[model samples]
Target: MKIHNFSSGPSILPKEVLQKASEAVVNFNNSGLSLIEISHRDPAFVEVLNAARSLTLELLDLKDKGYSVLFLQGGASMEFVRIATNLLNKKAGYINTGNWANNAQMEASFIGEVQEIASSKDRNYSYIPKSIHIPQDLDYVHITSNNTIYGTQYSEFPTVDVPLVCDMSSDLFSRVLDFSKFDLIYACAQKNAGTSGVNLVVIKNDILGKIEREIPNIMNYSKHIEKESMYNTPAVFSVYVSYLTLNWIKDKGGIAAMERRNRAKAHLMYSEIDRNSLFYGTAQQQDRSIMNAVFYLNEPRLTTLFDDWCIKNSIYGIKGHRTVGGYRASMYNALPIESVQHLVGVMQHFEESI
Candidate 1:
């Protein structure tokens, strides 16, 4: 049986991406070299890097729009520090939506003064707080576009006068959005892009080198740009797979098509959650994430029965995050609607059994 994958982050990837990447692991580009063994400076690997960066810009419609795309090694976790180190001089503002957003603010504090403009933690991050007042004096404002752990998403991004930076790790390329609204957009390539160990960082070309403090060569944005994202050896496999997956996305009608499909999948699962007697959704109606649908069982006694059923039915990684108890079905850009339907069938069947 083909197992359905539902883990959040380092989650599902396109079937074609996985298969092509597997072949390249042994022989990349038929050049008698494994992708892992290839040098970053090699012509073949350079082609992959260029393709990944160019495709990202093309997909986001950021080409020649004062933006530079870089495929960096560290995941989104390290970007919390890199962002602050490069941008934070006097202070910055953050909108805390979940654990990752809060962690980003904490990391920024270690670099410079940071303020929480708004937070939804009091409500257990069930909803996105609208109408946040961004301080005029801050260097930049950071927001996690989607909260993966709590299943809350900003249906509409906050408008601010300052530079709007977003961590789009969980929802990048899963839908269509106004990409130009952000001065800096960073995403770890685990969710909707590629596997882990690579991050896609896009910066508005003019957002660098205003700070008075010294920035290390490695952490500085200008240096990376100058080196063309080749400051050092890169993650060859991750970038190659990311390039292949991006091609897959392009072939599937790009972000517009993904947006429609994602909305349909989310609606299907959330409708089941609302109608079924066994489960209740944790997120607010308007703030539910299209990528992650999180809900919990109303009757706790049926947990084991449902779990056993899931295991027997080839459902994998539907368990919720430990910080928040429940189930999270991460329907990324690559997850077909059939998988969501299969999960809904399981939900309905388990409810009937109960």
Candidate 2:
């Protein structure tokens, strides 16, 4: 039986992507060298890097838009520090929606004055704070597009006067949006892009060189731009696999297609949760994530039975984040509608048994 992967981050990837990545491992481009063995500065590897950068820009409709795309080491976790180190001048504004948002804000506070313009933390991050106030006093406004832990997402982004930055780790390329709205956007490749080695950063060229802080060579966005994301040895296998994943995403008709399919998948699963007697959604209906659909089992006593059922049915990665324990069905770009339907079937069957 095939497993329906619902793992969030370092999560599911397309079968075709997996197959191609596997082939490259043994013999990269028929060069008799594994992708892991190839040097980052190798001309062939350079093409791969360039292609990945170009495709990222193309998918986001950001090509030639003066934005520099960089696939850097360190996950988005590392970016929490890098963002402030590079962009924060006097102050920056952060919206505390969930764990990652708080993490970004905490990291930024270490460098400069960071303000929480709004937050859903008071309610355990079950809902998005709809009433937002953007202060013109800040240098830039930071937002997390989706909360992987609590399952809340911004269906519509705020149009702020300050430069808009987003940590879109979980939901990047999972749907359609106006990419031009953001001055900076960063995401870990583990979720929708590829395995968990490289983090993608897209920053407007004009935003750099404005900060007063002397950024270290490694943390400077402008320096990374100058080096073309090869300041040091890059994550060769992760970047190559990400390149293949991006190719698959483009072949699937870009972000527009992903939006349609992801919407359908989320709707199917959420509808079951709402209708089922055994479960209910943890996040508000309006703010439910199209990528990570989180819910709760009504009766905690049956949790073991349900877990056994899911395992018996070849379901994987449906367990919720340790921060908020229940269930999370992460429907990233690669997750098929059938897998979601299968999970829904499991939910219904369990409900019937209950």
lDDT scores of the candidates, listed in order: 0.91, 0.92
lDDT measured at residue 141 in model 1 versus the true structure, 0 to 100: 96
Q: Which portions of model 1 miss their true places by more than 4 Å? A: none
Worst 10 residues of 2 by lDDT: 128-137
Every model's TM-score:
0.99, 0.99
In angstroms, the error of model 2 at 12 is: 0.7
Q: Which ten residues in a row are the worst by lDDT in model 1?
A: 298-307
| lDDT for each residue of candidate 1 in 42-85, tens digit (9 for 90 to 100) | 88889889889999999999999999999897788788999999
Per-residue CA lDDT of candidate 2, range 143-249, in tens? 99999899999998888988899999999999888899999999999999889999999999998898888888999989999999998889999999889999999
Instruction: Indicate the TM-score of model 1.
Output: 0.99
